[model samples]
Structure formats: structure tokens, C-alpha cells
Target: MSLNKETIRVMNVNIYCEYNISEKPPLILIHGYLSSTYTFHRIMSKLSENYSVIAIDLPGFGRSEKSKSFRYSFENYAQLIKEVMDYFHITRVTLVGHSMGGQVSLNVAKFYPEKVSKLILLNSSGYLKRANQLLILSSYLPFFHRYVHYHINKHDVKEELKKVLFNHSLITDEMMEEYKRPLLEKDFPHSLIRLLRHREGDLSSQDLNQIYTPALLIWGKQDEVVPFKVGQKLASELPNANLIAYDQAGHLITEEKPVEVVEQILKFA
Candidate 1:
């Protein structure tokens, strides 16, 4: 299935997205930190078969504009998502968020419950504090953004993918190219510095408890970034949540196990 790619202006920012229409409530796919709609390419087609699928590149990531002035907090991100839904005339949706996106989805459900019918999180980041004082403090320095850019740009894409995927064979030329695209943008480094300074910590247990929306938490047992233990803790905290763990997967569960992820989504959402 071919997706319609478009860039919509919201809150003075150009938000990039790929979508396919369907009668069912839309499935909003939100990628993790430093990721984009490309992260969901593997599962979007199959998911579109059952529900309208909309995958977006959050501000400062992917094809989206890297605005130094845009607020990067999870609360603002949730609000931006709601505005996107309104732009498409969508009332309610099933939110499918991976990693950092998962935390954003939770904020949406917490603050705008009426807009979300279901929540699906894959290897979601949880119970984490904001950046360390030293990093946050250093972001105040004039040239810190350059240092941030240099640090990330120096890493080999293949090595980075290996750390996220349990199966190294899945790393490919296309994946590397897509992952590296944003780094080449001139404004990316500055935007990333703002994101690092503006991002808030994940919601606390009390906040998680208040979100009663039915949720499905999917975790990769081998995930090194956000381990399976986090999923177990989330399932226990969330009022209506169930977790499913995949032994062979890792941080990139959506890419590593698209079929299984789709199957579970069809079953739960």
C-alpha cells in the first residue's frame, strides 16, 4: 500500500507525516528519540490494512523541521499530536508509540483521554529522570551543540543498529541511510541541544496510575536500552495493561518483530 506523505504546519512548525486512510479509528505511530516515520515503515502497511495508519516525524527529528524555538516537552508533543488529529478531522485514535514516543502517548492519554481509544507501547522508556545536571548545565554553553553533534556523528550506524537489534543481520544499507539522514541537516545539532535541555522526566507512578485507558505493553527481553523489567513494572502500575515479551527482539521491537507486533496489535487494539 502506498502512503500519502505530507507536511502540515502546526504551532509554527512543519510536521512531516506518512498516512493511509481507512474507516476505523486511526492508528497514530510515534517514533522514539532521534527516530522518524522511517522507524515504522516495516509495520505501517500491514497495520493500514486494518486501521488508518498515520506515522509522523516529531519536530527536530526525521523530515520534520528542526526549530530551535519549538518546545520539546512531552506535554507539548501530546498537544501537537492532538492538533494533528484535528487537522485530519480525526476524533479518536489508537496511539502506537515506541520508546520516547510511548511516554508521549501516555501524556496524551493522561491529559486528553477522549482523543485516545487505546495505547500501545514498544520497549517504552519509563521511570527515567531528566538529563544529568552536568549535561543539562553544559547545554547552557554556547558551543555545546557542536559537541553534541560531533559525539553522535562520530558513531558508526551499523554499530548503533547492532546495539538496538538482537539480530545483527537486520541491519542494512537502507536502514543506515535513513537513520543518518537527519544528522546531515545543518540545524539538527542546535535543535537537539534544545531538546536535551527542554525534555522532562518520564511520568511518575501516580501519573501512570491515573491513566485508565486500556494499554498494551510490548517488550523485547533482550532490550538493553529499556529492559524488560521496565515493562513488567509498567504492567503492574497501569490499571488496564498487559505485557508481551519477545525473547529474540531488542530495543527496536517494531522493526525486529513486525509480524508479532502486528498480530498483538490486531488482538489487543
Candidate 2:
């Protein structure tokens, strides 16, 4: 597959994205906290063969321009997706969101149902109540929020990846570099802080119930970050959804089981 990386100015922000043009009803891949389009690299080629695959670095993450103007809120990210879709002249899409991406997908499902024809939440965040008192309090103090993610070296990145992604063999040195790329950014701390504090304002149970879009929930049975029970709760809450729990996988199920994930997505989307 040809790698096509492009950038477009969106409201003064330089939004970077990767695209592979193909069949219609495009597939929009959204990544979670501290991640960019890199997280969806493995599956992008496979999906691109069948459908147009568009993966974006939402404002603060990946190669996208990060500034204080665009607050790292779910609604903001959802709006960005809408803008990108409009720019590309895409009328509808099959939205696939993993982790924090799931929250943004839910926000779009709640507000912009016309743009999203299908919704897939993979070990998504934003379901459970996540108001960390320490984090919240730290956000108020100057530079304290910055201090939280200031020290991100390779060792810590690997250890963090170990918790989220099962199967240590997949955690190669090159993979570590890809995961650490965004961590080295000067504004990474601010982006991390925004995600840490504002992520709590995610979809509620009522929001899940209200999402009538055809949805698929693929989760790892051993997901330590979000937990399998959370996926279960979300599947039950969603009016039209199916939950598929895979064994020997964790929060980074997309990376762990890309083949199965692509299979599931192809079957559903």
C-alpha cells in the first residue's frame, strides 16, 4: 500500500493525517490518548484494500498541531472529525474508535448521527466514572500538570505498554520508538494533561442508550486499562450493538489481534 501522508489547515491548526482512497462509505480510524495514527498502522493497509481508510492525528496527538486554543474535549475531537469529513466530501463513514477514540466516536454518534453509519468501540475509554482527585487538583496548579508527564523515557514507555498491551513479543524496540515518538514532543505534557483531566466528561449511560447506530464492541477479556466488564456494560447499554471478547488480549487489542480485528471490522462494517 502506498503511504499517503498529508496535512490540512483546520482553524489555524495543522492537522496531519494518512489516507488510502478506495471504495466508499469510508472507514475513519481514531486513536486514543497519547497516540496518533500510528496505533492503527497494522490494520490500515488491510482495510484500505476494501474501503477508503482515513486515520487522523486528532489535534493534540501524533503529528497534528497542538495548541491551547483547541481544548482536548470529546466534543472538540468529534467536531474535528466532522470537519475532516466535510473537507474530504465524505457524506458518511464507519467510525472505528479505540480507547479514547471510542469516547469521541460516542460523542459523534450522539450529536452527528448523519455522518456516522456504523460505530465500533474497541476496548474504549469514557464509560466508567474517572475523576482522579489528584489529577484534577494538579490541573489547577501551574506546571504541576506539566510535571505529570514531563519524564517519559523508553523504559517507562515499555513498562506502560506492557500494562496496556498483552504479549510482550509484540513490544519490539521499533514499536517502542513508534509509541515514544509523540512523547518526545514539547507540547506532549500539555496534551497528556488535557486528556487526563477532561476525559472524565465522556459518554454517560444515557448517552450509550441513546446511540441507536449499529455498533460493534471488540474487547480483550484481560483488558487491564478499561476492563472487560466495562465493555460488557457498554454493549448492554448500547441499543444496537454486539460485544466480542477475545482471550489473551489487553487494552491494546487492536495491535495484539489486528488480523481478528480486521476480520471483525470487515464482517461488521
Candidate 3:
């Protein structure tokens, strides 16, 4: 159950990851925005027992390298996942993505269908609810930029961490520190701004129609980030998909309901 961590160079960038190779097609874990693979710690070891599991810190997050020059688009993120897969010579996989990672996973299935066999989305963010015009605009002004920077740096990430799940008591000092790590990284702020600036509406119903891969949607009914209603609509739109909602949980279904999430993932796969 111990995950072996490694750093491998890909396209001149060093990518950090923890993985275990077992069977042919592996279960790949993709973390959300401002998050590292550490969030998946609760479920990875158990799943790794029966399936080849790989969880990584996408570039600019976690232990991965960050560079202002790198593109932060969903396509770019998906391509990075492909690079990792190719590095391991893994051709087919079942992708498990959370929030922003879900958006990347959808793109991967849309553009690289052959590489994905099944998908598991935990409160995925393919559907953009509404845009914060002020925030996006503020990212441009120097004064506002520094203001935003200070806000991000000083914000008690634990407050938001509490929102990610239903129970605030579950928030741990270790988890708080892990989520705060990227904010301290030099280039992470710029990349975060870039991602926010590029934030667009959700994929159109027509656009989602193109993803024919079977998918499992695990959502928390109280999810504030991406509502359970979004998950319901997504399930209806995906050609082959089903959704499971936990009433007491919030956005962080994996952390809020790890056993349920892992059970559904294993059952679906």
C-alpha cells in the first residue's frame, strides 16, 4: 500500500508523482485546482491493492515544477496527463478527476478517446456556473494584482477547506498545510491568475454529447462549488453515465465519503 514517489522529466519540465503499477490499464488520479495528489491519500492505497494506481501533482502544483511560461489551459493539462501516460507506456486508463481535474479529464476523453476507457468525476467543474468579472479584471491591474496576491497568500486556506467538505471538524492541520503549499510557490500565483482569466462557460450540451465513454459521477448534495444539480444534468447529458449523490457530503466527496467514492469507483470500473 506504500506509494513510491518519483520525479520524471517531461518536455523539459520535472513532474512529481506517486504511483504503483500492477495491471494493464491503470486507475489514474488527477487532483483539482490548487491541489496536489495528497488529497487522494485516503483512497489511493486501498485501491492500489487491486489495481495499478497512479496519482500525480500536475505541473505548477504540489511537488511539480511551476513556470510562468507554461500554458494553463485545460488542453495543456490533458496533454500533460498524456505525456505521463506515454512515459509509463500506459495506453489505456480509468481516469478519476476532481473539480478542475474533471474538466481536464473530460477534455482528455473528448480529444484522446482511445486513451481513456472509463471516467470517474467527483464534483467535476465542466459546467461553469457564473463568472466573477471583478476578479478576472482585477487580475490585470498591478495594484489590484498585488491586492489579490496578498489575499491569496494570507487567506486561511482552512476556511475554504471546510467548504470543500460538509464537516468542518474534518479539517486537519496537515491538510491545511498541504493546500497552502502551492500559494507559497513563486510561479503558482501567475498560473492561478491565468487559469481564472481563461475561465469560460461549461461545455455545451452538444459538446458533452461527443464524450461516449462510460462515466461515474460521484457528487455531494451540498456541493457549493459544483452543485449536485450540475451532476444530475451531467449524468443525463453523458451518453453512458450514472451519478451517486451523498446527502451529507459537500464538494470533496473523496475526502467526505472516501469509502463510498472508492466503492463506486471499483464497482463502476
Candidate 4:
């Protein structure tokens, strides 16, 4: 069965989410940085046939209202997600996060392991080595930001969108529009700024080994944002974790190969 989308207001933030209940265990799909619940549209529809699926737009993205005053750290986002789960009376869930969302899932698994049944990280950030820190910082500057944003405006947004995507070709005009339309809203930029400022990917090796959750990690072999080696690192650290690498895809594995991604998720579930 297909899930009907819904929205709920919590702490003055509008959270856009879709909930579909079936007999099987519920799945919570979390999108990556600057992404909305729409990222999981295809997967949700397919998985809902047997398993319940709940996909939400994190605060400051998609239909979720950005709280400019709040600090947008991954830890805070995980707390907000915990609150959302409590609001729905959902005790146990399998969290499947893509990119930034994967990082958030790791935070949740760390802080509230009781609530998470399983963890899935797809092209996730947070396992970067010491050497890559400098390169990531360079992209945070205003000059580069303006250059990137300018190109996004000049080329139907898809041109700039492709940069963050692992599989650039899958970033179609339609996908670009879906991702861009909400970003044009007045508060989006500030929210994005807060997200960047608060992003910290310094998870300790000790902590990584502590996550005993059944985890599945997927990475695009050509992922430019989080290298394939990072996935290998994550798989090594996480106990009972399996890693899958997609050779032809980029960072946006969900968009590039939705069918295979969903199939892998089902097998893991």
C-alpha cells in the first residue's frame, strides 16, 4: 500500500512525513543534507507493500520549517528525531539514512540504541580520515559558496546539484526542481548555514566500535563526497555490519539505482 503524506507541527516546526503501516517492522528513512522526505519516494512506495515505512523531512529541509534560532547539530537533529518517534509512539525502528542522514542515524544509535532496531548508512559522511579534513573546509568558504550557488541558479539548478551527487547523470531536471523549490524559500539559506556550521564528523574510533547495532553500509564506488574507502572504514568499525559498493553509481546512490538499493534494503530487513 502507498503511504499518504502528512504533516505535523512540533515546536513550531512543520515536519512533513509519510507513514504507511503494514504487518512487518516499521522502517524510518532519513534523507541526507539539504534533502527532503521526497528522496525516498520510490523506495517507500516499494517497501510499503510489505513493511511499514515512515520517511520524514528533517528540520530546515523540504516541508519542515527551519528554526533559525536553534543550533543545527547532528546531535540535536537526532534528539528531534527521537521526539518524532515518541510522538508517534514508535518504540523500535530500523533507521536507513543516506549521506548526512546516515551520520544522524549513527548519532541516534549511539545515544538511543534502544530505539533503533537496525542502522543502514548509504554513502554516509563521518568516517573521513584526518587528511581529508582540509579539503572539506575549503568548500565552506563564502567565495566558493557564491560560485556554487550562482551556477545552481544559472543552469536550472541541476548543474550545481550534480556536484554533490555521486551519480551526476541521475540528477534530472525533475529531481533538481524537487530539491530546489523548497530551498528557494526565505529561511532555507540560514538553515543551511547553521547546518554547515554545526556539522562535526569527528566520531572517535572507540565510539565507532561501540555501536553494536546490526548495520548495513552502502557506498558508490565513484562517490566524490564520501570516498568508497570511508565506507570500508565504517564497515570495519561497525560490528555485524556488511558493506556493498556500487561501481557505476556516485554519491546519490538512492537516486541513481533505486531498484538495487531497495532490493538490498529488503534483503537486509
Question: In order, how many clashes per candidate?
Answer: 0, 0, 0, 3
lDDT of each: 0.93, 0.85, 0.84, 0.80
Residue-by-residue lDDT tens digits, candidate 3, 143-173: 5546656878776798888778898888998
Residue by residue across 1-269, what tens digits does model 2's lDDT show? 77589998875678998998665559999998778888888898888888888899888878998666666767777888898888888989999999989989999888899889999999998555666788677787987645666555435888998998878778988778888887777877776677667655678887788899999999999899999998898899999999999999999987899999999999999
For model 4, residues 161-250, the per-residue Cα lDDT tens digits are: 676666565666678779888767766766766666676664667888999999999888988888888899889998779999988788
Better of 1 and 3 by TM-score: 1
Backbone clashes (count) for model 4: 3
- Stretches of model 2 off by over 4 angstroms after superposition: 130-137, 151-155, 196-200
The top-ranked prediction according to lDDT is: 1
Ranking by TM-score: 1, 2, 3, 4
- Sorting all predicted structures by lDDT, with the top scorer first, yields 1, 2, 3, 4
Least accurate 10 contiguous residues by lDDT in model 1: 19-28
Off by over 4 Å in 4: 128-156, 164-169
Per-model C-alpha RMSD = 0.9, 1.9, 2.0, 3.8
TM-score of 4: 0.86
Give candidate 4's error at residue 34 in angstroms: 1.7
- Show model 1 residue runs off by greater than 4 Å: none
- Estimated TM-score for each candidate: 0.98, 0.93, 0.92, 0.86
lDDT of 3: 0.84
